[model samples]
Target: MTIPTDATPSGLGGSEPAVLSFQDLEVQFATDLGEVRAVNGISMEVHPGEVLAVVGESGSGKSVTSMTALGLLPKNARIGGVVRVTEKDVRQLDARRLRQMRGKDVAMVFQEPQTALNPVLTIGDQLVEALQLHGVAYGNAAKRRAADLLAAVGIPEPARRLKQYPHELSGGQRQRVVIAMALSCDPKVIIADEPTTALDVTVQADILDLLRSLKEKLNTGILLITHNMGVVADMADRVAVMYQGDVVEVGSAEQVLVYPQHEYTRRLLDAVPRLGAGRAQLGIAAEAPPIITDEVPALEVKNAVVEYHRLGKPSFRAAEDVSFTVHQGEIVGLVGESGSGKSTMAKCALGILPPTSGTVAVYGEDFNRLKRKDRKALQKRIGVVFQDPAASLNPRVPVGDIIAEPMVIHKVGTKTERQRRVYELLEAVELPRAAFNRFPHELSGGQRQRVSIARALSLDPELLVADEPTSALDVSVQASVLKMFMTLQAEFRFACLFVSHDLAVIDMLAHHVVVMENGRVVEQGLREQVLHEPREEYTKRLLAAAPVPNPEEQRRRREQRHAMLAAFGDKVVEIGDVPHGPEGP
Candidate 1:
């Protein structure tokens, strides 16, 4: 049975007819496992000039429901009920009509811009093709309109950017191009699926601002599907909370987020790591800080610089004059935007990428001066957990082998002993011993990450390097993983260098924080000093840009971010209107 909700449109869309509506929608897919119901009977609507955010954890039908709007569901999908875009029955639309309505009446901005766009095609070519295919413009006229769209989305050098391929543009730039493509025909409604999930907080803030600006200026309704509550707070006028393929709650952002009536919604919000909520927020009691003993630190970098050499052009300096120390049993968070040298520094610290200058010391031994055999011996004392477990863990390998491979390489124990250790590790990460025989593909994302963590701890290493390990997970899953990681860290007493862009997660897990910008450490100190009382303007701006889960608080933070931008001589993204020029007809 569907739960009762306010259901009525509010805010900018009040009393206006809905641009998109779902009436008792149901979706099911036929799989090898059997017929699985992905979406239950969900009824919702998005009104012109209003933002309706559909938020839930993975597999909760948020994406499935949105996909129905564009008729993008798979052939195996058995869809029921009505999905109306501008009151046109989507289920009844013919192929040609569906294509005609796709970019003209409604469009979609996918989650990953890289996959949404064709890599081989230039940005200009793709945009022009979209315009031409939609019968919006043609030839030189389409090219000019493409440039205008890029500019409208705030990408500088729009004309120059048009000639570059997707790989040439930064992540944020590529997203802007995708948005430009979505707006080529001035669609009445745009469906954005996890639009800012992969972006850094500052870039995420910018993208949200851009979307909000475009929605108000063009009066285009938006259907936003994401698991990010902070994003909902920032963008949504109305909120729809989905759980187990059903809409459990629906109302204004304030009603749903601030005063959630559903138990699931409350749990979801509670899982979100607020910027200032330290370990105590997750029920992890704060322990005394690690003792500063005379023993060598677990890892130390001294004026390190890492550079990537080009064929003939100047070398790209990824990190410069970077220095920090991770003490034994301590977790040091390295925070920065993408390409801000966080990962590069991690690689150098791991000895995967040798620094161009300066020294990296591991347990008081200089990694650069170590002999090959000694280096391998030293490496055996360290472990690593990458960001994407699916890519990092071999698919064909069973969970048992993946965890035991590290011990095997180092010849740590006999076969029986290794299997025993693997079992112990499975229990440590809160995974069943039965998971030992299962492949990585068989596990859920959280389980796969748990496997990764289990493998990292198998070697009993003194230090660990974890790079954005929880970035891809849902809030609830992330909270659980963080709690388990804290428990394991306490048990193992290993020092960790945790790299991530999420300030909230950093605040929750890190004992000390290091802020980086343009490959330099701008600030480094205890978590309280760096987060609560940041001294640098950049740090303040970063904190201000991070969205809180509360709509009221997010609004105030938005204003504070705008003021910070202005104070730093950086103007907020102001996309008032598309300019008419000779480049267009």
Candidate 2:
């Protein structure tokens, strides 16, 4: 079941097929009461040797459009309009042919790799199965190519990963493996959906560079679907801004990213955290709430030491004399890369693993010296939101019950009070009350996270420890969620311990910042100071890796070049002033 191909460009077309084109595409789903038009009249064209970015927020029909192009929708789906590939139409193709086109010609990288890949099967076996099913020569040739593909996607020890299951790999590694699998068949047009959502800023940059280089070398057209405007600036040659199933704006990257005329487009651009951008930059002058410490800090980790003793070698001291305080009403950001022991320190703080030698105090109560019952109460005070909401949530439980469980455990309030609080908390996180009856599976990743936050806040704790809360969300959605947390913090006067690898997010949220490396506090200061002038080497490295809207910098560069041409046209090689641009060069 091959999806259809559109007509190729005038010259330099693929002999394989006319990449992919959408003409008046409409996708509708029948509901219990009425018809839902998910994708409405979207017309797009993608040629070889180009990257066409489809940018929009969730429910904006970007995913529906791309997923429908490969015949991946439900059986009852109603699809109209022309989706042509090669000389055939994708919408007209049967199930078998559509399956063939999906991996071979049009490869798609879904948002979540944990659920996308089979849990039982090893990555190598999955790759082998894909190769065989898609008409690849088995034996040595298939094995060799699989290894090459893994290495190409920046996965180290490629051969070992082949034998490893999806769970064995980190979230970032799993995403890279999916990208590797997508590229295995030499797809004419690759659709990457939030490809870097799970990756660190540095890794994201590497992946983007890899995609650009590969696309150029293979002359493949890339249909990148993401809500991250920063990515659009970096990789997209052209873009189509979609909202509510309609194309609101379409133009070259320079036109759409820099000179965006649409309000929605402008908002989308502003949503991404700019490296040098501040609230003052947007004319919204605000300050972080004052830190509230009751006798002792809200959460005080004094001389926290955690060590990992590896077999047949010297023991590793992960956290060496780590000490920090997250006071009430203050958001403290912990920024670092993977394996820097950021999560390890978080686990120590949560009492998931007791520290080797440290004093942890909650509300002036020494938690490290408490009994099990006392510790449980202490744990309730420090609410934690994990990285992956789906994996953290129980699939069988309803969302409302999930949020209510905390209150029930602590017996903080009566049953009626707890239920009432649940709805209020849900509203606080911007989730509908009806979501209470729904399972985690029914919600989007972002929605599930909102539920997670609502559940954390249900306990009415004075402190919230969110570990990479917005790491996997779209930029605009992330901004909304970030702002929501800030507002909630102000309203409730609760402290927040925001753990993230992204500096841009830390810049926006944290009043005070703490940079960690190998579980030690490398740098600690006020947020404004840390972001502007990072003193430690590790802190500077992390700052250097922050992702900004690449277009803003690129646009500034182009404008400077144009100004140079205008100011000293024809007459010269005069390389005068570069003219101070909008921050990053």
Candidate maximizing TM-score: 1
Give all candidates' CA lDDT scores.
Answer: 0.86, 0.76
What tens digits encode model 1's per-residue C-alpha lDDT throughout 100-123? 899888999987787789989999
RMSD in angstroms, all models?
A: 3.2, 8.5
Worst 10 residues of 1 by lDDT: 1-10
Runs in model 2 with CA error above 4 Å?
Answer: 1-18, 279-285, 307-318, 364-368, 550-585
lDDT of 2: 0.76
- What does candidate 1 score on TM? 0.90
Tens-digit per-residue lDDT, 351-432, candidate 2: 7877778776667777567899998978888788998898899999999889999888887788888889988988877778
Evaluated against the true structure, the overall lDDT of model 1 is 0.86
